[model samples]
Target chain A: MKIGLFIPCYIDAFYPKTGIATLELLEKLGQEVEYPMDQTCCGQPMANSGCNRDAKETEALFIRNFSKYDVIVSPSGSCVHHIRDNFDAIEQTDEVRHVRKNTYELVEFIHDVLKVREFPWAEFPHKVGMHNSCATLRALRTASMSELGEPFFSKPKTLLSAVKGISFAAPKRPDECCGFGGTYSVTEEAVSARMGLDKVTDHHDAGAEYIVSADTSCMMHQQGCAERNGVPIRFIHIAEILNGARS
Target chain B: MSNKPVPHAKLAAEFLKDEPHRHFHDERLWDMRQKRDEQMHIMPEWQELREQASRLKEHTLAHLPQYLEQFEENARRNGIHVHWARDGAEHNRIVEKILRDHGHSSIIKSKSMITDECEMREYLEPKGISVTETDLGERIQQLDNQLPSHVVVPAVQKLTSDVAKTFAKYYNTDPNIDDPHALAEAQRNAARPVLLSGDTGMTGGNFLVAETGSFVVCTNEGNADLSANLPNLHIATLGIERLVPRMADLGVFIRLLSRSALGSPITQYTTHFRKPKKGGEMHVILVDNGRSERLGMDDFWTSLKCIRCGACMNTCPVYRRSGGQSYGSVYSGPIGAIIDPTFNAKKFSTLPFASTMNGSCTNVCPVKIDIHDQLYKWRRVLAERHEIPFVKREIMKMAGRLLAQPTMYRLAISGTEVALKTMPRFVLYNYLNPWGKHRELPHPVKETFHSWYKKNRLNKAKQHEETQA
Candidate 1:
């Protein structure tokens, strides 16, 4: 299958390790992957701020670049969510429709599509608390969220537990948003920062050494807030954890 | 109303100065949401209940004119006077005229948010008609001369000590008393005299039952029933959208209402008022107050489906952290974020942007109002109207251009890297930097993913394809 790697702009710029891990892990699973250099973003930042006119060009650029791939995958949920749910302006051609339907965030592709039960090369000896980034939790329907009380299971937690030597401590409020919220982190920084701080405090209280999530956008916001407030916790991407290889 | 409006972002930051209090406030409401989830688990058909309630609300709103007219006709037939007010001022005037006609010296109210929307206390109190709020939370806020920050838990943000002090100062209850039950009983005793002796009683309707021409009001405190039962004149202020087509529909709403609002299976007082007491008057005033105009704007028309159960506010993370007062609207939280912009864009413009668009409010909504989506829509509408900050418009324009073209995006990254590497903290974390005020920027890496991909991954994959060909 032809797989396209769609790198969200912030991930491409700030956390290249997540994109690299995504690339390496997919190849380890023996899937053909292509990195489209021209693909920058899903036009979320502009469209979310109500700049539809401004997002149009990026939207067009995205369509022109990655429309041919049988499957397009990104390490971020928020970007994919914007394309599937909020692309109201795009002409709904077969190609545009195909991209929307075929595109998946990395974890959903792994949990729902790959359905892997074991990771022969992965090992993470750490107490990890998972952050259910809001876009991924609610928008992508990746798992039965803690908010909706069912026999509870998580897609990220399922996959992460496959790795050897990793323990999971679910936060007190497992599904409460980390509050990175794209531009909201900066626009409503006070509430946004407080939310991040509280979230980290939950994980810390649960005795997590590191916090991991699928969307680096959230990791970026919370990680920055943790560092600023001296919260004594670290953040990482799910891709990096899944790509973990032991000697 | 005329001064410069401080946007939600700035006000939220100001509120966060007291971070310890903010965390405590969040946990208290979050516990209610957690309890709501516990209640949902006991009933296996929780999602189904939500869907049926949503559909019923949608059906009622779609055929609102018919249900409303039927409700009015049925209400009048049952010896209940039905009055329609086009707006808030009109609604207040109608209530005042009712007071005038009856020669009522005082009125007792039981948690009517519509009256707050009408600014009724300010209107009636100055006119020599004293209005005492009967709901305990409302009574506290009334004594404090403050708007109820939350709709369901009017004083949800207030600490127990604050209520104890209020009770102590106002009613001469134990000033040092801190036990919740003791303080509550003291206030309840104080409110009993005022409520029983009042000439008129006013309350808000939760649902207007079209089939029976009766209205439903739910409360845990039993204040509405007490006020409605004791007074010679009982008035209900209902927004036109508060209608259920059939009495049978009550089961779905009754199950979902308090569970969503307070995490309880049902409110203590889910009283249905179909008619007046013997030799007394029952009046139901139907207030539109821009709700009809909202029905015309199809994009936002679904907002009328709100049940005002306050579940959206309870589950809202932003509202949890920012508190209700920061919203600067009669209604606060996610619902206000959407509804405020619809009513007055220029004044409440920041409310729409207050959300992180995390979309939790949409999940918890009993009527499934699509609140976060509406908030997004409101932002676009305001941006189109040029109601957002000029800096945001300018930055979005530049970022849009940079993101559209890969080369420009890359070039801008270079400059951003340079700025991140070199700029002083004064510039990055200064008053002008909204994000920088509270959050430190994640420093950009030297080599971007595109650079790494181009150097190693892209060409190798292309060469493999070439060999395949």
Candidate 2:
């Protein structure tokens, strides 16, 4: 399968290793991948800030960058969700519409499309908790599907559970946003920090050594909180773990 | 009085300073939500019911004018005099006129956010008509002569001791009373004399069904029932958007509403009054109060779909921690953030930017109003009107300019990382960095992914293209 890699601006700038892990994991699964260099952003930063007018140029840039690929995939659920949900409104060009239809988040892409039943490598022996990002769980309707279907094929937790030696513990409230919304962290800084602290506390209280999630943005925020508090709990992106990277 | 509007952030900061025993409240509410969701999930039809309720609300909103007319006609036929008010002042005047006509000096009111928004108490108290708020939470805030911090849970910010102090000051009760239930009973006892002597009882309607010429008011404490039923004259104020097409539609809303708001299967009392019982007078006031104008505007019409369950408030992270008072509106939390700006645009314009649009409110809404989306839309509208703070506008504009260009974005990211890493932590923790107050900035990674990807992936791709050629 030819997969077009969509590097979200945040991933491109801050955490390139997540992108590398995604690419390596996909390749190891015997999937062909193409990285579009010109793909700067999914226009989320602008669109989410209520600046869709400013996003127009970036939207066109997005369409131009990855229109031809059959399956466009991104490591971050939030970025993929932004494109799938909001791209149509950013001038519904045929290419943009096609990209929206074809795009998938990494976990959904791997589990749904590839049907990978198990991880290629053994996972580290530690208790892990999964924090669902808001965009992925709510916007993509991943939570609904997880509730309905089989363990392997349906839920993200089930998919994460397949990693050998990794025991997944449920959160006090499943699927709550960690409140690290783009620009929200800055604009409503105090509230965002409190929310992040609460989420980290939940994971810490769960006896989980590591908190895993699909979106690095949320992980980064939570990780910042953990580091600042000098808590030993570690944050890992699901893609990094799925790709068999151990901390 | 301070000229400046109540500083919600400062008030919240003060409240959090002590870190009062809010854990029990949070834990209890969270537990209730979990149980509610479990019950809701037991019935596979819950999602369908939500959809049905959403559609019903949409239909009602689409033909609001006709349904409202029908409601008015039915209400009049049932011996309930119907009045229309264009705005808050007119609504208050018409309400006061009714009181004046009856020669009533005092009236008992249940928790009506609409009335509060209209400054009804402020207006009526001056007219020598004592409006006693009957809801336990509202009554507590009333005793303190403070605006309700929350729409549903009026005194959500107040600890039991706060209520005890307010009760002790106002009703000369024991300040030592720390038990919530005891304090509530004391509040009820204080309100009892006022309720009995009051000539008219006023309550807010959750919905007005045009088909039955009836309105429904839901409450857990039965305050609305007591307020409306006990008095000789009962007055109900309903926003124009509150109308539904038929009585049956209430079933769907009632099921979704309580579940969403307080996480109950249903509120204790869901009273529907078609008309006055026996000989008692019933008056229905259909208040436009800027709603009809809001419905005309496409971007905001969806806000009218709200059932005012306050579910959004419960789940909102910003609201949960900061409390409703932080929003500085009669309506607080997510729904309030949207509704307040619509009613008083200039005064509450900063509300939309007060929190992150986490989209949890949208997810948990019983009526399924895309609240976070509307919040984003409101931000756009506010920005267009230059309602956003000047600093925010400048920052956004600069971000827009930088983010528009890939090179600039890449350069800016690298530059920021370099600057942050080299600079001392306190240097970056200045007032300008609002995040610095509570959150420590994450250390910048030495190498950004863009550079790594360019070196390892993009370069390889170019070399492969050359090799293929």
Candidate 3:
């Protein structure tokens, strides 16, 4: 299958490795991959900020870049969700609808499309706790890291729990945002940092060595607080762990 | 203190600067969550009840005009005078007229976000009638002359020391001593005379049961009960969307509301006033104030299903940390983020952007309003109406172009990695990047998947095809 890679703008600019890993992982599963260079963003940052007016140009740009791909895959659940929810704005053309329908978050892409039963790489022995990214958990409806079930049917906690070396520690406030809500971090910095710190503390109190989640944006925020506060915990995106490359 | 409206970023910074207070507040919210979870675990049918309540709300909202008419008729039949207000100003004017007609210059009120929306105190005080908030938290905020920070907690943002200082200043006591209990005593002493002098009491309704022509008010502080019972003229202000089809619905609602809000099985008072006592007159003001228009919009109609449980608020990470003040509205957190826009989009356009769409609010909500989903919908609505910033619009346009194609996406990924690796950190930390303010950007990797995939998967697929050929 020819899979179009959707690299979210932030990942494109900063965390390109996530995009690269997503490409390699799909190929390792024997799926043909294509990169659409025109792809810049999922319009999430603008849309989430109550600036969909700003998203129009990006929405048009997204449609123009990835319209031809048979299957669209991105590492970020939040971005994929933005596309799924907002593609109608760009154009309700059947082609746009097809791209939106085919676009999948990496885990859902791997689990459902590829149906991989075993990790190709070896598993690490360390115990890892997972944080469910709000968009992926709520929007994409990814499996919960804390429970076991169908990945797409339940919250992302379930899906995170399925990864090897991953043991789920229930959040004190389950399913709460870690407060790294894109622009919210800057606009509401004090509250955002405090929320991120609270989530970090919760993970630390749970005796987690590493906090894994699907969204890099949230991990970035949580990891910053941990690093700044000299907290011992580490953060990794679920894609990095799921790719099993570190092992 | 500036005459200009306080930007959310500045407000958050001020809140964050008080590290000790933020810590205490977060800790208290966490404790509340623990208590709520424990309570939820005891009831196996809790999730079911949530579904039922949600369905009931959905049904009521779908046929809102009918239910509203039904509510008006029942309330009128019960000897309660009913009035409708088209908007905030109208609501305030109608309320003021009623108070004036009843010869009430002073009123005791429970916490009501509706009043907050209408700026009722600002309206009433200017008219020479004093409106005293009776809920402990509301009273505290009222005394301090600040908005209630959180919907349920109201005073969650204020530390006990802050409360003590405010009380000391008000009662002419020493500010040096900071004791919450003493401060509570002081407030109680100070408020008693005001309560006695109050002629009318007002409270926000939790649910206005259409069948009984009555409404239920829930509160932990017993303020609503006291304010209602003590005052000769009792008035309840409720949004038109607050109605339930039957009185039996209260059993489901009352059971879930407190548990979801604060983890209590029920609040200290869950008073249901169907009719006024013989000497007293009970009045119900069914305020539209933009709800009927919101009900007309399909995307946001679910927001009307909110029980105001504050479970969504309690579980909201943004709300828990930021407190309620940052949303710049009476409602804060997930539910507030969505609903606030419906009530006042221009004022609260930034609310939806205030948090990551963590599904916690949706999951924790007893009535299950799909708050995060509504936030997403509101983004589209806000965007369609040109509510978002200009810079964000251009960036999204650039992104939408790049994401739709596979080849460009690959080129962009490879190019971005090389740039980030060679570029200075400050370049990535520019003002345009919100993440740059507080987060370290993740380092890009050496090779992208396209290069690795072409070398591995495509080659292997070619070999398999060649073999087949």
Show where candidate 3 strays beyond 4 Å: A1-74, A83-86, A90-99, A109-115, A145-174, A182-194, A235-247, B1-6, B398-433, B444-469
lDDT of 3 by residue, A65-134 (tens): 7878888888887788778865545557787788889899887777677766565463545566667676
Q: Which candidate number would show the highest DockQ if scored against the true structure?
A: 1
TM, every model: 0.95, 0.92, 0.86
Q: What is the lDDT of residue B350 in candidate 3?
A: 72
Which is the winner by DockQ between candidate 1 and candidate 2? 1
In order, what lDDT does every prediction score?
0.86, 0.78, 0.74
**Residue-level lDDT for B197 in candidate 1:** 95
Tell how far residue B141 is off in model 1, in angstroms: 1.7
Leading candidate by lDDT? 1
Q: What's the residue-level lDDT of B457 in candidate 1?
A: 72
lDDT of 1 by residue, A158-217 (tens): 998899999988678888888888888777888888898889989999999899989898
Instruction: Choose 1 or 3, whichever is better by DockQ.
Output: 1
Worst 10 residues of 2 chain A by lDDT: A145-154
List iRMS (one decimal) for every candidate.
1.4, 2.9, 4.4
